[model samples]
Target: MSRLAGRRSAVDIVIGVVTHVTHHELFHDAARTLSGVDLEWVSYDHEDEIRDKVAEFLSTTRLDGFLAGPVPYTASQELLPPGLPVGVIRSSALDLTLALYRAQERGWGRTPVSIDTFPAEAVEAVATALDLDQDQIDCLPYAPSQSVDEIVAFHRDAFARFGERSYVISVRAAVRGQLSGQIPIMSGMPVPATIRTELHELALRIESDRASAQRFAAGVFLISDAPDEERARIALMNHLHNTPEFAGAWIENRGRRGVVVFAHKALFERITRNWVAVPALAEAAAALGARISAGFGVGVSARNCVLLAEQAAARAELAVEPCAYLFEDSGVVIGPMGPVGAALRYSYRSHGDDVERLAKYVGLSATTVSRLAALDQELQGRTLSPGELAGHLGITDQSGRRLIRTLDAGGLVSVEGTAQHHPKGRPTRLYRLRIAQALEAQPWSSPAATSSS
Candidate 1:
């Protein structure tokens, strides 16, 4: 069944497509068959303009996803915000074949041709299939570090080497300007079919993420040390009932000293700013003089969710401070969620002594390393900026940057790219946490490792 089959309302997805001016019509033609998606075009006449255009597009639009070819993506990759779904349209074999056919129509035979950006294997495969001489085909695969000048040089040198018998086929739009009149050139842009498929796939991914965020979740709030349990419970209930954030939630008393609230996980995410903090806990303590500890659970069934929430609440009670904890069906526990800077999260699942080993290797505490592991699991392969990581871990931005440096130095994180949140200043560096992989690679002298060996 389709993931979007039972959705209540049509999802309005906005996708930003960054392309050269020449390919704008191509992208639009490809998106004509798609529904429920509005494509905001960010077209650039030159590669130099891509970065500014992308930054302008992002600042003005609320895009659900982004798509660009390799050249534009590489040029402006560091400008894209984290967590925005991105699709990089590469030149497919079909695109290459079509370009070759067009070249043939123009009286430029397939042989004695120079191709750029397509993989050498793809070039070889197409050559073999068409019975063309592979020896006459010069190929240069795309690399992130390869510049426009370098690409132009490869074609120019190929033209010089092959003389008038050779023509150039390039996926890069920039090459057309450099070698247009100097040599016979054919554009190898991705065809509309390739773009259409990529657009559909990206739309489905956006919808899937939206649906997952809206899944039902339960939260259990307990008056752990109230002098008058009934009054404290009533106060907690009243506070939650009156809070605008909980207006959509079903808030009711669960026990003598507890109240349960049920709502979509997205609501909680908004209230907690993506589980960075639970201001309600502190608000209850300060405003109502009721020390409330919160436990939020997400599971398959309502009953099981409540049970997990209760368990999480008990865990929160173990803390000396008023805080909240999250217990997911996946056995990931994130807790001590008071102020953003004081919270710590760790998985309930055992990693044997890997956490300890990683901690030692990185010169950080086991608890911190474990928390990172839990965070990495929760992120599910999404890259985050240091500021976002800091917010999640409840630490200062500087501390977050320092932590990233530590993790990077210890080989536990990789630089994914940069993200520009605002229109000004330098972009923030994005990093993907590799704590789980690092922990898995940690050499442990435990019985589990020994027995497995």
Candidate 2:
């Protein structure tokens, strides 16, 4: 900061992490409060590239000073080329060292360490603030950064690993004086994402219980049966949002469809384990003929969060009686066979009834109608040969053909296509359920959707 002092200089700080914007903002405020040096920040999708670009600002450039906003883990070859005095400020080295100690203390030690730094302090701050010994404090050295190229790549890799979590492209501390800010950005990720796939797999292990959640995020679950369900949910939402333990949260009906409960993704594991759903919903389910279940998901972005919540909601059905199974993995994944599965089965059964309706129209026997329904259900709406239908219904294949032809004459079922078996033998006919008229009393609404399944 002293380097930028007293000179009419333009300082550019490029940063990678959105959460770290506040730290940079404070730095600028202090400059105005103290040195009065003007600094401009240009934000981008990834930080490593931004740092490399900032590093190049040194060549053939008449800039006053450069601050690497938490650059390449401090004091490395990436330290703004050492052509000018550059200070790369991280929030607190001592605090970080203590965090490392806490993690290591859990015996979670390993080589090539990584810190998310978001949840550590937010959780334990009030209970335990900056208490470390000299041996413990030494862990906070600027992490080794070999070159600007390697250092920037490291940060980008870290950001990439945080995939499917909520992230955005934003700019802050805009440059008032300029060289143009147009630069090509590259992100190799697929569009329309949810949680990082790896993270979701890990989340599977985390049951929605109390203690397990303490590891993921802060705050406790707010079950329904509170004086007012919506009011309680709103209060908890606001409360968690304000807390550092909050990454984000949602309100779910719990196992009870009618009631709402507030849950923090940070604490979902505990809640799941506890069989916690909104009690009000449980009460309402008894009143309604059908039951209700609910669950919630959490993380960095609203879209990913909704995906998570829906995943939880899907699982809640598994816990409840109607739908008793939920599967993990998003998009085109198979689900369990409880109530929702039963609902699907019932729909197919209802469609089979049209065979009876057609039987009445064609004046076929009760046995014939039952046989046709059985064959139709298995064929999945595809036309079946009378021989195949007869084989399916334990009748002689030729007899089945005669039966189908009689029905075809009445337009109950149709021989839509034919295939020649042998020039001498005969041509095989294909018959399927005719939809000339609507069947009565439909079941479970329309066709199954992959989204709900």
User: Using lDDT as the measure, which candidate wins?
Assistant: 1
lDDT of 2: 0.35
Q: What is the lDDT of every predicted structure here?
A: 0.77, 0.35
The estimated TM-scores of all candidates read: 0.66, 0.20
Clashes of each: 2, 26
The alpha-carbon lDDT assigned to residue 48 of candidate 2 equals 47
Mark the regions of model 2 whose C-alpha exceeds 4 Å error after superposition: 1-24, 40-42, 59-61, 69-83, 93-142, 145-453
1-453: candidate 2 lDDT, tens digit per residue: 123233553332221111124344443444443232334343333434454544454443443333343232222223333222223223332334444455455554311232321122222221234443222111111222223333334334543554422121111111101111321111211111111221121122222122333422211232333455555555444443544423444433323223233444334433332222233233333433234444343444445544554564555454435332212222111122332223211112223334433333333433345445544556667887877767776766755754564444343465566778788976665667653232332211233100110
Alpha-carbon runs more than 4 Å astray in model 1: 1-11, 78-81, 119-138, 160-164, 222-233, 254-258, 288-293, 307-338, 341-453
Model 1 scores a TM of 0.66
